[model samples]
Target: MTRLRMGMIGGGPGAFIGPVHRFAAELDREIELVAGVFSSDPGRSKAAAGAYRIDPARAYGSLAEMFTTERARADGIDFVAVVTPNHNHLPSARAALQAGLPVICDKPLTATLDEAHALAAVVRESGLPFAVTHTYSGYPLVREARARVAAGAVGTVRKVVVEYPQGWLAGEASGKQAEWRVDPARSGLGGCIGDIGVHAFQLAEFITGLEVTELLADLGAVVPGRALDDDCTVLLRFANGARGVLLASQIEVGELNGLRIRLYGDRGGLLWRQEQPNTLTLHTLDGRTEIVHAGGPQLGPDALSRTRTPTGHPEGYLEAFANLYRDFAAVLRGEQAPLLPGIGTGLRGMAFIATAVEASRAKAGWVKLSV
Candidate 1:
């Protein structure tokens, strides 16, 4: 099989997610980094390219230059990964798609609902395979939870509670990651909600296969002088008559990527925590609890396909992220790939952020999602 050439936009030095994307993309050895416009600064871009061992000639100064040069090459990039801040996602993705390249982008789609809608329209017209990297959905056990819920093992999900909290922003944020996230101009209207709350929202909907019909959100800027919210709570109403609660805060005192989800149906409840990703707990109506370990015998094909290590060896964040890339590469190679989040997911995520922001501003009244 020919290795797919991949290019990236943004993720320069001091950027947190760029390396994570590189690690995950290379983990399966199905794709390779060939080109990038890593930063607005030409020097930084060249340095980042060198760090990735990309050919200097392929390291362009801008996305347009990279797209133009690569598209003219015999071995141009098969796809582009947009790992920039929220504001750049739309323009970067639009350029790549216009150049006839597929895109695998980070979450929340774009900085705002308008950009997301515009990009979604472009994606529809282009007919390219676009993916949104909702990393939690890539976990084997998370897939198992989704499968079980779909198979009626849980029997009609009634309620969901998902929370993602981190203390990193409990006081003041100073780093590049935190800086852009707390800035409205760079991160868009929904701050904490767009940052990590979208993950919690997406995970709940992904696992239960339910759509949020409406939501009431309460957002706060826990740390003084923060321009945007560092804490948020949302009440969700699912299309299937199910109700849910979502909490995402960066100001939680002792938290660290503390993302956890629990789905309760009429017959049972399922729980999965990001920190303890290797195992899923099931609580039945009869009071019996079962712990399903990753790489175990009871998992379905979807889960099995995502699991790499043995039952006890463990597969964590990077491996979960790699699953999306592996599947995306298969799709690019004209093979069948597992279901991954796509343009629709991206649109809905943006809509969620927009609706939450509006609802919060309106004193937390329930608001219907427009997506």
Candidate 2:
């Protein structure tokens, strides 16, 4: 099969996730970054293209020019990856979809629920493959956890606890990444929630296969006078009457990307942590504990397929992210990847953020989760 060509939006010289996306997309060699508009500055975009070693002519100064030029080429980019800030997701993705291209966007869909809805309309109308990088769901162990839950290996899920904590924003932050995240215009409301809390929200439901029916949220900035909530704690009611608690905070003094989930079922419990991505722990009602390593034979078929190496070789963020790109390549080739989280996941995530913000703002006791 020919490698699918890719065009990127964002990921300029100082960007973080843009390079990460590039690396992950090319890791499997199933997709390649053939063209892109790396920055708003035409000079910088060309410089980035030179740095990436892609053809200089394909380094477009604007999205419109990139799409128009690429579409006219016989070997155009097979899809566009939106790695920009939340504010730019809608425009980049909407333009690509309307131009009859598939899209793989960064999470939270858009800065606001309304923007998410509008972009979603474009995606549906285009009838193209749309994927959102909810990266954790691509992990091999995480996939195993979902399979275990679905197969009733842990029985009926009764409760879930998901938490993501980071200390990068503990003090005054003015870095490129922190700037847009702290600004409501760029990152949207519910700072912590929209940023990493959405990962926790999506992970819990992804593994348990239960929708969040209602929620009570307590969200605010722990720092002196920030505009958005940098700390959040939300109580959740699942569709099966299960209870959940989600904690997402950027003010934790020493924590660093500590995303973890624990789900308790009637018969047992499942535990997985982002810090330790290679192993999954399961405990039974009779107190028998089991450990499933990433490449072990005990893993389900989906999990096994996502693993790239033998049992001892550890796979972390980049590999998991690449798994998403790999499956996305498959989807682009007309294969079904049930585990791939798409635009609907993005919509529910936007709904989650909006509901959480409204509940926190109104101090509402319990609000129905509407998507």
Candidate 3:
């Protein structure tokens, strides 16, 4: 089969997730970055086309132009990747879907719940394969954990604890990533909550197969004079009488992407951590603990399918991200990618962000989550 072509929005020079999307989408040789309006500025967009090794003529100054010109070409992009900030997600993705192309968008769907609703409507109306990059769910072992939980490896999940801590923004925040994230207008109603908090929330539900029905939130801007939240702790109530706690913070002292989740049920528990992406620990009520490696034996079909190397090899963030892209490519080919996150994930993420931020703002005792 011919390789799929990708058009990117945002993630221009010095952008973090932009290059990440580029790297991951091409890692499996299933997709190629052929065109993009890398930056809103015409000059920067042209420069990025050269950096991406595509013809400068394909680099348009606006989303409209990119979609219009590309569709008129026989070699147009097969899909679009929206790697911009929270606000740009709706317009970029909407344009792609309206033009009869699929989309792979960054997390937090949109800057507001209303935008997510609008985008979700457009997605449903377009009838295309729309994916959202919730990165952790792409890990092989995390998929293993999900499979185990689903197959009754853990009986009746009762409690879940997920935490993501980063010290990068603990001090006075700077840099392109820091500046936009802390800005309310660009980052939406939250900073840390809309950013990594949604990741924790999404993973908790993704693995346990339960929905967060209600939450009590405590969000704060720990750094002095910061506008948006940098620290958040949310108490959760699940649909199946399960209780959960989601803690996402960018103001921790020495933590670096310290994302970990533990789920305990009547019979046993499952634990996975991002720092050690290859290992998943299974604990029993009798204190028996088993270590499950990424490429180890006895893994479920879903986990094994997502694995790249043999046992003892490492597959980190980029590989996890690539798993999504690879599976998405198959999806674009009309295959079922059960583990791939989609528009529903984006809708729930926006709900989670809006609900958590509003609850914290009002100090509401326990607000029901509508996701």
Candidate 4:
């Protein structure tokens, strides 16, 4: 099997998501990182690439130059991973795709709806697989939830309650992580909504197989000096007559990545939490509750395929993120059509962020998702 040679666009020194992406990409051994334009600063980029033991010639200062140089190499990169801030995703992705390489990007597809649309246009024109790492969608049990919902185990989805909260920014700012995330220019239109709320939105829709038709958003800034929202709550209306609520925050004191989703339907309901990803709670109308464990025989093939451990062991955030990369590598190798969440799911997330922001700005009015 030919290993996928990968290049990175960001994830220089002190960049958070970039290292996580590297870890995930390396886990399966099916992909190899050959080169990168890892930082905006040329010196920083050189230092970062050196730290990873990449060839200095392969570590260019800009994405365009990286694409050109890498393409000229006989062993060029098969794909590029875009790990920059919201504003840089579009330009870097376009540069790689135009050079005929597939792309895997981080979420909130672009900084604005217009940029996201333009990206979609390019993706359609390219015909190359573009994946967006909505990491939660990579969970094994989440895939099970999606399968069960699609199979009508939950007959006619009625309501979805997905909430994600953390206390990292409860009262005061912390590090560079908290700084860029709360800034309007770097984090995009909505803060908490764009940062984490969109994950909740994507989870609810992905699991229950229902599309949100409209949403009413209520966002807030719990910290004193922050410019953008650190907390948010949204009321959602699904196309299939299902009603829902989504809450996300970075300011819920003492709370970790406490993301939970509950979907209720005519036949039953299903519940899953991020902190305890191995077990999925299923509720039936007949008053029976069953716990679905990852890698068990009861799981569907899709869910089973994502699991790397036995039934009792645990697989959390990093594993989930790796699952996305593993599956994407499979698709890139012509093995499948992306059973895992990819560009389409990322586009949905961007739409969710745009809608929530518009709704919150419109005095908490309803916003339609046009993406």
RMSD of each: 1.0, 0.8, 0.9, 1.3
TM-scores for the candidates: 0.98, 0.99, 0.98, 0.97
Q: After best superposition, candidate 3 residue 333: deviation in angstroms?
A: 0.3
How far residue 351's Cα lies from its native spot in candidate 3, in Å, is 0.6
| Cα-based lDDT at residue 16, candidate 4 | 90
Give lDDT tens digits, candidate 1, residues 126-178: 99999999999999999999999999988998999999989888877888988
> Cα miss at 277, model 2 (Å)?
0.5
The stretch of ten residues in a row with the least summed lDDT in candidate 1 is: 330-339
1-371 per-residue lDDT for model 3 (tens digits): 79999999998877899889999999999899999999989889988887778899988899999999999999999999999989888988998899899999999899999999999999999999999999999999999999899988889999999999999999987899889999888888889999999999999989998899999999999889999999999999999989999999998999999999999999999889999999999998899999999898789888899899999989999999999999899999999998899989889989999999999999988999995
lDDT of 3 at 311: 91
lDDT digits (tens) for residues 1-371 of candidate 4: 77889999989888898889988998989888889999999999988987777788888888878888888889999999999888888999998889999999998888888888889889999999999888998999999999999999879899899999988888667677777788888878878888889889988888987889899988887788778888998999999889999999988789999999999999999999999999999999999999999989999988998899999988899999999999889899888945666667777888888888777877868777778
lDDT of each residue in 1-371, candidate 2, tens digit only: 69999999999888999889999999999999999999989998998987777999999999999999998999999999999989999988998888888999999899999998898888888899999999999999999999899999889999999999999999997899998899989888669999999999999999999999999999988888799999999999999999999999999999999999999999999899999999999999999999999999888899999999999999999999999999999999999998899999999999999999999999998999987
Q: Is candidate 2 or candidate 4 better by TM-score?
A: 2
User: Which candidate should be chosen as best, given lDDT against the real structure?
Assistant: 2
Kindly report which residue pairs in candidate 2 clash with one another: none
Q: 84, model 4: CA deviation in Å?
A: 0.7
Residue-level error in angstroms, candidate 4, position 122: 1.1
User: Which TM-score value belongs to model 2?
Assistant: 0.99
